[model samples]
Target: MVSWYDPLVLAQTGVRSIISATIGSQADRRLLDALAAPKVEPSDFSVDAAGRPREELWLDYVADMGDGWDSTYTIAQTVSRPTLTLKDETGTTHETRGGEVLVFGGDEVYPTASVGEYEERTVKPWTAAMRGQRPAPHLFAIPGNHDWYDGLVSFMRLFCQGRHPAGWETHQRRSYFAVKLPHGWWLIGTDMQLESDLDEPQVHYFQEIAKRMREEDRIILCLAEPAWLVAQVRAPKERSYLNNNLDFLEEQVFGKKVSVFLTGDIHHYRRHANAEGRQKIIAGGGGAFLHPTHVPRKESELAEGFTQRKTFPAAEESRRLCWRTLGFVGHNPKFGVLTGLLYLLLSWMQVADLREGGTVTWNLGRVLGAALVNPGVILLSALLVLGLIGFADARFGRGRWVAGVLHGCAHLAGALLAFWAAFAISGAVLPLGSVPQQLLGAVLVFAVGFLLGPTLMGLYLLLSLNGFGAHPNEAFSALAIPDWKNFLRLRIDKDGRLWLYPIGIRRVPRAWKPGETAREPEWVADDKDATPPELIEPPIVIGLLHPH
Candidate 1:
């Protein structure tokens, strides 16, 4: 229900982003350490039905959720099911039960993190899905950047406490956690607050965890951001810090034991593997807006020794979706209203009366000249250009400024042209009254501006993304497509093999009706055309690759 294109949402998020960068930078990490809770021991999660250490585990991973209700609930419904039977790409049927442990990788709430947003967007849907389940899964989460906007006070209170958000039990004491899986496997979730380096306390916590690991132990490291993919897209100087932090943790604390890296910041599903069989995956498509997988291109190598193995919504399909940006005004009508108002303001400021031979006419030249001399108009124009520049992603480096300036100019040019066309039309058809001509021109400019403004922006975003690999986040967030949601289900069997099942929801339900019973989900998909979850690919099995 929340559109990223909404002007209010954009404004609020912009302010939060600024505050988090300035004030939060100095205090958040230190506060995290100061309030660090008692760490959860691996033994707490390793127990089996017999109350002894187990040799196998089943867990579910989802992230970047807590957005629109329909999309978020659709994912929650599928994951909360007692069991799911899905056919892989080869038409072979595979059955998987709901995970015993549910891990939310990052960005549990979108736009901004707050108790109300978390309750409505996350808790309401998840709890509805598990209304009367007998044995509920345990919940764990790592804070993403959005969660850190409020210095993680809300996130920690909602998730770190041992409260049950749904039927699921919360057990993690800190923002970061370590869980001992069966068969010498460990699942570690790290909170890299706002892309900063790992806090000292976190490093020490993982160091203590390392002391308990056996030589043959393997780790499934959960990160808030996919630093590997980030390193590929960012400038050279900006790339190394996050990657270096992970490298240090791997080499020193964990002794190079991480066999799989799991993250969800990018909002899609992608798998990459190294020659050594270390797997890196991005499965952030829990419920947030879909992010295109075609970016950074298929040929751009992500990390050293790593090659991309698979991507959901194939690169070609992703490219095709970029074309949908042409429907920006249709998709985001309220945003169009904002653009329309801006155009009206500009048009009103430039309106000039020209009288010759007892006839009044609206002239494009006079209107433009008047606008140039107006101080308010100039200030507004400058702000518009600067705002667009600021909107550019820093990852684009210097090209961002160029893209911003050009994009702003295009909007300005389009507006002027709309004004010219409106003035000419009114002058040709209407009588020579100055007030009537100006009024009609203003209305026409607003109508045309609303349509043309966002349309121009959409075209700019589409061209930038497909042409230069820029604005990957901005381009797609504008569309807010609710489809192609995905999550991961993993099983570490008694034999110590890790089985990964990447589940995809091609289309989320758009309508919902009340459930028939108390045990059923409070809301069920009302549309008979709802699509069932499917396997993205064949089940991926990782055999023991670490040296004994």
Candidate 2:
């Protein structure tokens, strides 16, 4: 698993994100998807039993996986099994088996999407879990932003081809696909690419699928991002384009047949439902860092009449976890090392003579004046201010610039104080030689920087998230909590009723041992350490069995 908090990892991801965004804007990849292969027919996905379309079907949905081995493998193992008997909050038992179709909603691999990453983080673990399983499930995936880092090359090669990633069969001809399910139900996965705009080819592709649908046919629309949740947070002018695209599809393509908006990318489980019985679910917790559920206000609706009904890690628990940011140094020592080095370099650049009449003297004014005059220090300072401003949340609008400036100034002030304190303390303790005092002061400065810099950064992130509703992704990714993971299981019964089971894993096992048999997951959670999965809520029944 990539340590997101590691300074080098953060730098690499940031660069990749910038590059991908730039490339996506200049060259649209979705337009090329049609040229890659012929559009798949909607009827291709109908589940068949005894050479006929079955009236009942079971399907599994997971996303934001391909991280740490233990967490990813744990989820893979659980979902790959033949049967899972779990209990709901009311103590009622529910038995479910692995889905005939496994849909990875988005972000199959983390850090960046590459062939190597997919093989190591996704394919290997899944292959291990599904080894020797019979009647392999059909697999489908939609590309999230991370997957588009490589322009969907790796994503297409892994999922779009009619090849098996593990024991599952991949039948989708393109990144986006339409699956015809039993009882006039359909599963449509749309690839929004980096930008949320759907290409003309994709629009026509779905429109073609729509022509075959009856007026009563309901859709389980799978998306990479939950545009509803995004729309709630961003301003109207800056609202998600994905939501707009869905609106177009609803208005022109499928009408009001979309019953469920299934998505991942948030790395947690949340459900919202409107009065019309339509559901919008975010179940990204396949296997990634846990994101906080408390960031979004309780009173806010995800969409028109769609109020949040369930969350896996309750808001209270999520709020409690925010305190973990205080231990930022322990969580990300490598990041701290970067900050420490930066502080030391800045301090060294501003080091004053501090020698007077055979005694080491501390002078803040002298150090500040020296730093102000130094061209290198001035340039570094400017870069620091600009970088911090750029790092501020864009959602904050102009306020982000103000916040970033203040934040940068605070760091500069803190660095100055640290330098002064280092010299003062060293001068007071060390003997009267200028060289010895300077050496000792430099050591103290580095020590203080290493310890205090990251702690301050953590506090800043925590305050930004809690106080200003900024840096939600950064704050939680820093924590890297592996618990509170979840996924979804959907079953369309013979009666045509759609049942959704949201399963939650409170804690993933930290230890693993090799399985002795081929039928078992190659790496099984140690029996003593295993935490069984349970339903986050009772099964959510969507749409009437027989609609008028």
Candidate 3:
């Protein structure tokens, strides 16, 4: 059974383990320094008397991947939270308990390889709650696109161990590594750097590992970004080298049968059956921003034995529209004045209709049809976004929108489109007379207006609301609940890979006091759905150790 844990905690532990390994006998000394190191500490937060946090951070989901992290590893952790179960082809169901050995998919930090960045953004918040947790599971990690943002200096210093003299430059002992588990299970991890010709050593190294796996019953291949998933969405040239149909190498080079392939990167959750009918899962939903939502496509659905869960049953609110501030068109006289163009685009159908026709033509029937025909595209784009949002929110608290104008717009659009499609099809059965033609046009207009009207209204409201305050003034208020008892819950999209809602994670608990808002233990399936240990901020790394 594959058990997933919090990504941030996994990254923190990986950094801790690597540093501990690198410092060797001085591991204790280095740890002492890390604990005592003086640094800027982000403020501790709590909900107001009404059960809402005074401050909440806005996080952007990762989309533009870079060279990627050095390595990705998947392990299990044993926490008091709960357990989830996954059944193999043999009808053997394995339960995944919380707080198991953590897995690392890659790009634990962002923009730079600075230890401070990782510690501040990921570690500090994570370790705060697990302070005295015992028997922390072993850690494994892989490189992601962003980890290479600063030449991977921060990653190497924080996570590498058992290295060669040439250091990480050599392929044989780079980021890719393995761990033999108690069962016949073998944990195989890899680095996404292979796309930039960073896998020569890893490829060779894995060949030997795969050969050894020939004798195992199942192999858990770890990846920062799901390599197969990328192959499904990316152009052939844009595909990562790590995904060079390496599974084919199993029979040819390793003389073994590969069972499961694992990956992360998009900060979501996904599980599928590979070409060989083996299981492939994407479990990146550790402590990161929830990804956007998407519908599944056809090729992905058509793949032999392919099954995806796009929407969760519980998160009906997700069916609403999400308002994203695209860009601010300021008056820059130095450049060609473009603010005037915004008004023109909104008013003129010829200019905006085709450009945004994708949305205009975005009928649910059409989208689902497209998904049935081309699941690959859907898998690449929307599924990633939807899975990320659904799973992340299930574990952590952050995403929730007001059921207002935005939702009204989405609902209106979907309804109108359904009516339009139904009526338009009636023309074939009924006579194609004046009545049919007029009805078609009317349906089309209704659909258009239903979708666009609320969107336009929402824009107007935002504009008005923003104008209500002066520059540097904020209009949006915190929506946090002061008590854990008041916490809202959400689910994943149905018809996607997971094909379940709330994706098996438990409901978020409400806060204790009216003015005190904090997350209770997650409702994992095990431990009778016990409470999470404690509430603390994540860790932050402040320094780096260069080449050994």
Runs in model 1 with CA error above 4 Å?
A: 29-40, 298-300, 353-360, 365-379, 393-398, 546-548
The TM-score between candidate 3 and the true structure equals 0.44
RMSD of each: 2.3, 2.3, 20.7
Task: List lDDT for all candidates, in order.
Answer: 0.84, 0.84, 0.35
Of candidate 2, the 10-residue stretch with the lowest lDDT total is 352-361
Q: Is candidate 1 or candidate 3 better by lDDT?
A: 1
TM-score for candidate 1, residues paired by index:
0.94
Give the per-residue lDDT digits (tens) of candidate 1, residues 1-548: 56889999989997988888676667765445435664536535667767897777889999999988878999998998888999998999999989999999999998898898899899988888776543678888999999988778788888877777776788787888888888888999998887557877788788888899899988999999888888877776657778787888788889778988999999889998877878899999889998998888744566568888889889898889998998999988988999998888876666543345775545767667766888877888889999899987675687888878998888877777787788788877776456787688788999998899999989988998888888888789888988899999999987888899999988899999899988888888998777899999988888876411
Once model 1 is optimally superposed onto the true structure by TM-score, how far is the C-alpha of residue 182 displaced, in angstroms?
A: 0.8
* TM-score per model over all chains: 0.94, 0.94, 0.44
Which tens-of-lDDT digit does each residue in 333-412 have in candidate 3?
21112212221222222212212433333344553444334444334334433433332211112221222333333433
Q: Per the 3 Å backbone cut-off, how many clashing residue pairs does candidate 2 have?
A: 0
What C-alpha root-mean-square deviation, in Å, does candidate 1 show against the real structure? Answer: 2.3
